[model samples]
Target: MSQFAGLAVELEESGVKHEMITYSGAPHAFTVFGSDRYREDADKKSWMAFTGFLEEKTGVKAM
Candidate 1:
């Protein structure tokens, strides 16, 4: 999580709005389709968070 933490700090210093999520026990590429580490809960959570972030940045609601 050090990498994520460093990025978060950089984003904070840059004053950019962002979101970071860390799913415990989730491997890299957990969201990749057909991967053994794919997690439904993580996918759903990340999707919603991403959509919300997009909506915030673009001022366009996701359908």
Candidate 2:
């Protein structure tokens, strides 16, 4: 497994609550808009996940 995947597994085993989202075929910095490595699908999905998590925790929806 990749390093981050291993870390996620460890966190689960240790009872740490967290979310892990991975984008297949997304290069590094895929979330950076307008960059050469930007991936629209991955970027949008990741942004949604991030905002959703924040809303879930703080009960404030992102604009």
Candidate 3:
């Protein structure tokens, strides 16, 4: 299963309101704003921040 799918399942099981938002046909490396920008460092940072935010908000570790 995809990471997104697993995360959605976990969040649902935790009774947290969550949605998987995706832009169909968009490249994996693309930014959320669709800027065609790819930055490995920034992506890692963003992912960490997002995960931290989710944990803080939901009191659940996504992983």
Candidate 4:
């Protein structure tokens, strides 16, 4: 999530338009387990933080 937050911040700082997508349910199911290796408690937190940062930075509601 921190990574994504950073990206969003970078994009905003650079004057670029960007959008972020977040998913519910088991992460593995959504990606066909593609994120198996990347899944972690910290990653989940990062994602949440990223979403929050995106909303605050872009003034866009997250779906």
Give residue 63's error in model 3 in angstroms. Answer: 1.2
Candidate 1 per-residue lDDT, tens place, 1-63, comes to 888899999999999987677978787877988889898788888888889989998999998
Better of 1 and 2 by lDDT: 2
Q: Which pairs in model 1 have colliding backbones?
A: none
Q: Candidate 4 clashing pairs?
A: 1-46, 1-47
**Residue 36 lDDT in candidate 1:** 96
Best candidate, TM-score? 2
Candidate 4 global lDDT: 0.67
Worst 10 residues of 4 by lDDT: 24-33
Query: What digit string (tens of lDDT, one per residue) describes model 2 on residues 1-63?
Result: 399889998999999988777898898899787899999999898889889989998999999
List candidate 2 segments past 4 Å from native.
Answer: none
Better by lDDT, candidate 4 or 3: 3
| Collision pairs in model 2 | none
TM-score for candidate 1, residues paired by index: 0.68
Give lDDT tens digits, candidate 4, residues 1-63: 688789989999999987766543335344233456454554666567778899998999776
Candidates by TM-score, descending order: 2, 1, 3, 4
Cα-based RMSD of candidate 3: 8.8
Candidate 2, run of 10 with poorest lDDT:
18-27
Displacement of residue 28 (Cα, Å) in model 2 is 1.7
Preferred candidate (TM-score higher): 1 or 3? 1
